[model samples]
Target: MRHKCRIAQLGLPADQRKALLRNLTTELIRHGQITISQARAKALRKEVERIITLAKDGSLASRRQALGYVYDKKLVHVLFAQAPERYGNRNGGYTRIIRTVNRRGDNAKMAVIELV
Candidate 1:
């Protein structure tokens, strides 16, 4: 029984699942938004939030910790050096997920994950 589990697997194995979540989080941070399948967005949301929370800390260790999850070095640099300033005054709830029409290929639900 998958009782109270937090992750959204999106049918991927463990390593792939981790990579998907990490890449999506990096993209979302760089773009301030991203469009993807619903399950992916749901899975990536917590990770995105966690990184932003880390950004809020504004410590060197926190920046390095965040870099561990975000793959793009440029994007990671921007997040640590700039994003925190953009979102400095706010608390949490940095990301927003909006459901969109289902994808035509396989009828998978789609959603746009963005920052507010």
Candidate 2:
């Protein structure tokens, strides 16, 4: 019935999807904000939030865990360095997604996901 399945496949195979999300995570950490397809932004939110949560922990294990998803060592270092200071007082909701205009090529709904 397709019920209770929450992970969006994004029409890509496992490896490609993982790679896409990893790159997206790295970029978002590096740039502090990024524009992407609405569906991907929605799907990426969960992982991004989780990574931030891990970063908030500010532990070696948490850093390792974030590194697993965010491939770039430098970006991962930045994430760990900034996450706690940025979000230490807050509980969650570290990122905000704002809807934007349709993409010109495919008319896909676009959104900007930025660190809050």
Question: Judged by TM-score, which candidate is best?
Answer: 2
Candidate 1's TM-score: 0.89
TM per candidate comes to: 0.89, 0.92
Off by over 4 Å in 2: none
Q: What tens digits encode model 1's per-residue C-alpha lDDT throughout 1-116?
A: 88998667789999988987887887787778888988888778888888988888879898899878888877777777776688888888888899999999999999999988
Lowest lDDT block of 10, candidate 2: 75-84
Q: Per-residue error at 114 for model 1, in Å?
A: 0.8
**Model 2 lDDT tens row, 1-116:** 88998788999998999899988988888888999999999988888899999989989998888878887888888778887788999988888999999999999999999989
* Residue pairs that clash (backbone atoms under 3 angstroms), model 1: none
Q: 25, model 1: CA deviation in Å?
A: 1.2
Runs with alpha carbons beyond 4 Å of true place in candidate 1 = none
